[model samples]
Target: MGPLNGFTVIELGGIGPAPMGGMILADMGAEVIRIERANGTDPKQMRDVSARGKKSVVLNLKQPEGVETLLRMIENADVLIDPYRPGVCEKLGLGPEVCLQRNPRLVFARMTGWGQEGPLAHAAGHDINYISLTGALFATGRRGEKPVPPLNLVGDMGGGGMLLVNGVLAALLETASSGKGQAIDVAMVDGAAQLMWMFHGFQAIGGWDASQRGANLLDGAAHFYDTYECADGQFISVGSIEPQFYALLKQLAELPEEEFGNQNDPALWPELTDKLAAVFKRKTQAQWCEIMEGTDVCFAPVLSFMDAPSHPANVARNTYIEVDGVTQPAPAPRFSRTPSTVSHGPHSLGQDTEATLAAMGFAESEIKQLLESGTLGR
Candidate 1:
């Protein structure tokens, strides 16, 4: 059994963050019923990667019967997450108001780019647009360069999906005592700003410059805390910040004593970075790994997606596993007991429609009627 073994979550079918939020719940052992549409549209097409570890049921919210079916599922669910734009769920009659009426103790999680209410609440936006508004995009990439999009990590999953997970979990905790559920308006923009809390503190303490990108201590401007390419063309990341770690890194790399002076001086970075780059390039990445892998220098070879699974450290820790012949990351944050594992690979859309609907008390005749009416779509 998973840590969330007894918990049930009804995931209103959508894309990106909502599904990922459900993935987190499912990872912890919650029964996440992905409420897919019955039109035979496969949810796996959205993303075969993070879309793993959940079950799906088809129900067309456009039809009254389908909406009713979703509400009935909510009646037994402890949490429900939806990423539709504002007013979409309300129009479908499966909004927080209706859901709370059916199950007041349900955690109604609503995720969106802007939020449930705001000037841009209904505006269609993606990860780039969402993080752009939160000062996050402006702070990314090299200085004076266009803000390079960090592929959807900053906004979609990190901010939007992970924020929904935290919100739902917090609301669940509150429900244990209050016996009431609440709407979780998790806005991607807001979550992005929340994620910048550390950077905000650094600026407040004068440790960071808001105008510069890639210039901060943690942002790759420092020679001692950055990625270096080796002779083999592969890369290794080094983050030897402290004096001891820096000394160790220098010793491991066989650097001259004359190269050391004023570690925190911003003026010395460009030259030091050049020198370090030249030194690192003298040896192959493998050679550097042999010298630095298990040290306090916080070094690691920059493994590609295909290489990560077979890395010694990852393999030793069981961080990656082969499932159905697919190499993927294992469930993280391991437990002393009640360890989690991916139950299976991605299933066909509505593959569990009959089983899920039956478990929710739908009869065979009702399922047939719904399917025949073009409501269930499947």
Candidate 2:
């Protein structure tokens, strides 16, 4: 059994981070029921990995009876994850105010790009846009190049969905002791800003180069903390920051002491990086991995999506698992007594409508009426 075995979460289906938050809750043993639109989302989007370990129930929230039915279900739910624009949920009659009024113990989690109320709250944006406003995007990329978009990892998944999960859990824990529920507002841009705390500290100390990206120590400016191309066109990364580790890197790579010295001098970083790149390219990625894979020099080969599952270290840790013939990441942050597992992969649209309503204690007649009214799609 999982830690959240007895908790019930109602997920209002949307894209990106909201589903990911629900997936995290579901993975942790909560019984998550995704309330999808009756008409369904995009055909191609149904294959999302975040749908794993969740039950789907399609409902037409446009109908007043559908909203009522949803509220009734909320009566038994411990958490409700809302993924919509600012007033969309309120207009649909399922907003935090109304839902919390119906169920005082329900933790309402709202995930948005901008916050619930802000200058840009109503504006449509995506991961890149959200991260851009947070200075996180500007901090990425080479010194003279344009900011690099981090592929939605920073805003959407990490800051947005992960923040919602954390907020929901924190509120849930608080509710457990207070016997009262509260609303959690998670904005991707705000979360992205929060993720920049370390950089903010560096800036305060004048250690970070705010004017030029990729010039900071942790960025690609550091010769010892960047990726290098190998002879086979593959790549490996190294992070020999400490003096001892830096010496080990030089010793193991057989570099001359005269050339590899001055490890911490930023002025010599570019020249040293060029030399390291040339030397690394002399050997294949596999050869480099063999020399430094598990050593203290802080090195590893760059593994891609297709290569990650089969990597020796990943295989040893069971970092990924195959379910129903689909290879994906396994549930993470294992617990000692209540280890989590994927119950199943994403289900077809409305696959659990009837059974879920039945479990919700809806009368057979009520279920049939909702089906007949086209409010509930099976």
TM-scores of the candidates are: 0.96, 0.98
Clashing pairs in model 1?
A: 38-377, 38-378
Q: Looking at model 2, how many pairs of residues clash? A: 0
- lDDT per residue for candidate 2 within 1-378, as digits (tens), equals 778899999999899999999988888999999998867763224566888889989999999999999999999999999899899999998888899899999999989999999799999999999998888999899988999998999999999999999999899899989999998889999899999989889989988877788998987999999999999999999999899999999988888899888888889999999999999999999999989888999998998989999998899999999976778898877989998888988888898999999998999999999999999997
- Clash pairs, candidate 2, are none
Model 2: lDDT of residue 339: 83
| Least accurate 10 contiguous residues by lDDT in model 2 | 38-47
Report the Cα lDDT for residue 261, model 1. Answer: 55
Candidate 2, residue 347: the lDDT equals 86
Candidate 1 stretches with Cα past 4 Å from truth are 44-47
The per-candidate count of clashes, in order, stands at 2, 0
Give one digit per residue, the lDDT tens place, for model 1 in 185-302. 9999999999999988999999999888888898778999899999999999999999989989888888887876568898888789999999999999999999999999889999
State candidate 2's TM-score.
0.98
